[model samples]
Target: MTLRRLISALLAVPACTMLAAMPVQAAELDPVRVQLDWLPTGDKAFFYAGVAEGIYRDAGLDVTLAPGRGSPDAVTQVAAGNADIGAAGINALMEAYAEGGAPVKAVMSIYSKPPEAVFTYEGSGVTDLASTLGKRMAYSMTSAPWPGVLRQAGLDPDEVNMVNVSPASLAPMLAQGQVEMNLNWVTKQPDAEALMEAAGRKLKVLPLSEHGLEGYAYSLMASQRMIDSRPEVLARFITATREAIEFSIAHPDQAAAGLAKVVPESDPAILEGQLRASFPLIDNEISQTEGLGVFEPQRLATAWRWVAESDGYAIDAIDPAALIDSRFLDTAAQ
Candidate 1:
């Protein structure tokens, strides 16, 4: 059967029935906290949809979602056992493994591809990465992947005068010529574009993935101890999340509404644009083939190697497999 049909049929089934039909013994509903990598936005549709649609409750979980300051803060919360799971970039997880010896494993990938990119005004004379040399580039102090992109382009990041700018201020800074370029995520690209169009201007976005800086974007992660002790809970969470993601893909407008409810201050037009921008980044293939929270060992190994070699960590000291667990997702699929 086609995926659409399967998803439709799954949606038709009663949530209680689906929960009761699962073979593995269901765990009692317990409070599970998830720390988001940033504040509410359309990029977080599936998560908000899951909550708004009662997916987590149907899966027998009392889940609480918390906003994180950034990836590092989210990872720290998970590592400290204060949060059951944390949503963050896989790069942050690698850094945590290298520096803090945090036994956190990425359970589910949200964006299949890296969302980082450099944005410049249209006709800025900077058409590509090579042209960005010696230019002023604005970047967030906490964002990952920019360093890798600069290194791969053979540009010393230090050579470019860098300024700290908020994500929302990127387009404004570009429009005013305050910075030659700024790094942003694809998820934020739509909002940036909308903001530019509002002022009757245009911009160019150069995705880092297209420039050879590849890494998984957002992911659901948990500590090794939690995985060992509460595997069932993780599996249930993944199942519920997979249901939510599939729902979002099939019902984009509904997903947008769900996001709007959580982020009421967001402009509908901007939210719609953000949703469209993020569509290509969400990987249906990974969700279908690997189940919900499964991590590809080889892909993760590549990420770890990139981090270790560039960030001054001993490669031999880190094992990628130790930082991921697929059993929970696998169980959920069954």
Candidate 2:
């Protein structure tokens, strides 16, 4: 057939038939592995929410969320390249970077204030920080900040008889009265309170933040390699995460459902309560004044000071500025 006749014949074919002949090409998505500081919990529902809502995928990223045993594990994994980014306590990152030069830096702020608190059951007579001077308490590695906090409360760390135990044993010991109290994060308060209530007692929370504990707590950290080699991907991931955080705040129930879908063993109602409990930690005075996900210099310096003093490391060993890279956050804002 002549060229004009051939073109006319092709043009007469149905649009659906023409479309069916075309090959489908899926958009490529960048890979991002994220390690959480602890088990999948309500405070961490936002990441799961983001995944469930396809926010990361919409940003051209395939994100994986891995549960962590602790902030130390999360920091170690990120530093070792097993995770591109992680959620960890800033103090843990500071100590890891200062003590061993871990190649990780916080990219965004999560908890603006330390969530450490002392939990005790009713009738334990531990009404305030001063009341626990000579009482026995469960102590674990996460209790590092309590020493400095105790000193600030005008009580000697030595005055309290500390029973060394694993993190998992803290609640059991407190509920059974094996220890008068135990140190835990405020984000887990609801669960702790429920445990105490099950034991026919009320839980008394002595938040260390009110006892002169000052510093950034949980934060989003990234491996130096990722921050250096994949700045754009990191920015996109951060932007998507920030959006997920806002979504979690606005719809706690939806965030819980998202997390429950991924972590089927989780109770959505409990997760929702946990996410609600975290709002104060996320939207506190510092975050309010500086804007969300921002790291103010003075606060960073103060955080370093508290961590350094608590760990007996020289405050000058690692500059607080060296522990964070805000360029990605700036990029995300753009």
Candidate 3:
């Protein structure tokens, strides 16, 4: 063969040999089932958005979210190993750990600032903690933060007549005057406002975080088994989640749209409003300084104090630091 023909044959031989080389291996994604503290509300939109955006998949995780009735339920599910990780109230996690020694620990802080609030109709005359005295207030077992809020506001917990009610009944009760106020998170503010507006009344939000209530609220938690056996998986999950949260905060409209694809029952407009309300709770000054998903020591202690006081446990009933493992967060940051 001529020199040019010989060179061409040599190149063709390598191309054929390369095609027969060992097949390239695709990285297997780790499956992570996440339990949510509540149903598919806008507050839980980030996870759905992350899944839609392929952020978790890019991080080598296949993530699924399971809806929950409440934070306690979410915590229990994670501890039982029914879920790989979960979003729940820090207070709920603390209570479980203190009482039954549930084998779960918070790994990433979600609502770095508590979103607890007392909502009322504009004309209800319940403007502040002092004005709420003797007024009918709707509550649920999940309203554990209010007692601490009342104490901080220098009011006895019994001063207000708290009527036990189902979580769904709160907004309707407040609007219909069956209850002057209802305790809930700000993340639900938009929906509650819509209910009030339909009843021809304006909504008035009394954020507990502003009225002497201070502490962490919702967080991402994992069971000890997962933490011990799948530390790398936890790290990848946290990193992807942090990115998801940041994306949600920056593009709530897009995030809401993405969530709508996952939960078609949700109204994207309403979801956008709720996601906007959640911004301050998630990306506050504290989270900005300490970085997202961090459990600041003093803040963790303060959060535990609120939970203990509400549950009538000794202040030191459980060591606050022990309830969290920041190794995953540290690894994610790296």
Candidate 4:
């Protein structure tokens, strides 16, 4: 063989060998499922914004955002490995811990304050917790806030004529006098009011935070196995969510428009009102400073104790650490 041909053959042989040794390209993005606590609302703006803005895609995730029936459903879905992450109330996390589920941890707080409250019509003669006693009250049986509010108000939840209403039913029930009082979140009041106004009525909202019904409202939770195996994915998810939250705060009108696209059934005016109402509740600064999604351990402990004591569970049955993993949030914020 010629010297030039021999050299070329040698290079070609190595090139072929190198090609054989290389690993095959995998899927361009990792799949992740995020289960929301309920139907789309302004409270979930960050999540919707993340998906709408391709924030998850930018973070190397192919995220699927699913609506959960409620907090319990979201917890069960994550615990059963059906979902990679669940956004739900922290109170639900505590309840799950008390019940001994596949350990779950909250990675981020969506609402800086608890989102729940007691809402009444302007002329319902129910201005406070004391007034709600003996009045027909509407709430979802599965809502974590209901039990807390009931216990706090010293009302026999059963004696108050509890009505199981969907979150969307709050306005209609209130307007028709089907229920004299409604338990809901501050963020939801605007939507409820808009619905009532559409029916030529007005409503008043009383935040639970003002009535000693305080606890972490919503958080992003993941299973222990997922946290142990793919923490980087969780961190990336949190980072993207945080960015979406920041964007939502800075541009409420655009955020409302983006959220409206996701929940097409939602009234644009209602969503706009909710977006404005939720502005003060999304405290990205606190989350950034304390580490994304990190609730005060002491507060968590207090909440655990409250749940155990109020629900007649043994104190030893609860372990706050098992219910939450703040380290993922700390690493994500960094």
Candidate 5:
């Protein structure tokens, strides 16, 4: 066929038919391994929702969500190149960075405010930090309020007799009077309440942040290599995650179903409640002003100082700017 004749013949065909005959370009999905700081929980339902709903895939990521031992484990895994990213406490990351140089940097702040709290039974007369003195308490060794928080509350960390306890038994221990109180996140107050009510007791939750121990909470940490070599991949992941969080915030029930599909063992209602609880933590004055996935440098710097200085590390040991890069968040927002 002559070139002019071929062009004429193509033009004569239906545009839809011609388009169908053209080769389609399939975009390759980038691999992204995320190490969750602990076993799957309702509070983390949005991650499962993101996967079940194809949020990550739509954003060009072949994301794998894996259960991790804890924040320290996740940080070490990401720093050792065993994982591309880590979902863990921002304070833990700062601690790791203070130890030396962590190979990861925070890309997004998952919790705008710290979620640490102390739980007690009703009429226990354990009202404040002063009441905790010489009292038996169960607390996750990993998550007790730091020295700075203790000082802010005007209590000595050494005054409290703290016993390490698993989250599963923390409530039961309190019910049985094995411990006067326990510590956990306020978001889990509902579950704790349910547990206490089942055991015929009332619950009192005292959030440490309300007493001046506030700091940035959970965050998304990416390996420095991934940030440097595949910035677009991280940006896409954040965009997808942010969208999933927004959807969960708006439709907790539907988002819970999405999570239930991924983890049927988890009660959908519990997951929904957990997701609902996270919404307040996710959206605060800072988030309202700066938008999601963005962090205030001054506040972040202050948090770093609080964590590092309190931990007896030199202020220069960990540079807050280096630990947080807003470029990906800016890109994802746009």
Candidate 6:
């Protein structure tokens, strides 16, 4: 062969070898099933983003985010080993810990600020804690946050005539004069407001934190068995979750889109608004300073105290440290 032909053949051979040397894609990821506190809402962006964008996959996990009926349900499912991890209101976990027999602990403080609240119609004359006395309340007696909110407001829940209602009926019942106040989360303010507006009224929000229920709002929970036997897996999962949460906070539109991709039944516009409304609870000043996933010990203590007090149990009898584990935040942060 001529010198040019010989050179071309040598280059072609190396190029073919280089093409053969590329790395193969990794195998199917380890599955991690997660249960959320409630249905597919914008506030659940972190988990949806993880599933839609493959953030969990990149971290060597395949996450399945399931919808929950309520916080108590989520906690029960995780404790019963029905889920690998769960997200729910810190209040729910507190009540479960107070009652005993649950085998789960909080791994991350998802919301630094408590979102527990009472919403009333603007013309209903229920403005704040002091004004709610003797008024009818549309509440879920079995929901975890109501007792704490009532005790913080210096009112015995027994004093009020409470009509147990489904969450969907709260705003409508309040507007129709069936109830004067409704127990809810401030994260869902937009939906509550819309519900009231459609009924020709405006909402008067009363956040439980302002009424003295100062504490971490919601948390990521894992079984004690997982922490004990699968420390590395738990740590990795927490870290990936934290990263996904921060990413969703910074890129809400993108996050909403990702969520919509996973939950096609959700309206993207509505989900984005829900996320924007939930910002105050998730991205508070304390969370910014301490880093995401960091829980305040005092907040945890206050929640535990309320659960014990409201349930006729002694606060001194339970160690708050046993209810939460912050060991994974370091890895989550990194």
* Top lDDT hit: 3
Clashes, model 1: 0
| Root-mean-square deviation of Cα positions for candidate 3 versus the true structure, in angstroms | 12.0
TM-score of 2: 0.90
Report per-prediction Cα RMSD to one decimal.
11.9, 10.5, 12.0, 10.9, 11.5, 11.7
Error of 1 at 315 (Å): 2.9
Worst 10 residues of 1 by lDDT: 22-31
lDDT of 5 by residue, 1-334 (tens): 6999999877877786878865443458888889999877777878888887888878878888889988889999999999998999887888887777788999999888788788998788789878878888787765344556777766787887878877678889988878888878777876777788988889888877677765577899999989999998988999999998887787778888887877878877777776787777788887898787777888788778777756777888877777888789989888
How much lDDT does each candidate structure score?
0.77, 0.87, 0.88, 0.75, 0.81, 0.80
Model 5 / residue 252 / CA error / Å: 1.0
- Give the clash count for model 6: 0
Q: Residue pairs in steric clash, candidate 6? A: none
Task: List clash counts for every candidate, in order.
Answer: 0, 0, 0, 2, 0, 0
Q: Comparing candidate 2 with candidate 6, which one achieves the higher TM-score?
A: 2
Q: Best by TM-score, which number?
A: 3
Pairs that collide, model 1: none
> Candidate 2 lDDT, tens digit per residue, 112-201?
888888988879989888888899989777467888877876789888898889877888789888989998887888887777788777
lDDT of 2 at 102: 90
Q: Look at candidate 1 and tell me the lDDT of residue 154.
A: 82
The candidates, ranked best first by lDDT, are 3, 2, 5, 6, 1, 4
For candidate 5, the per-residue lDDT at 276 reads: 81
Worst ten in a row by lDDT for model 6: 22-31
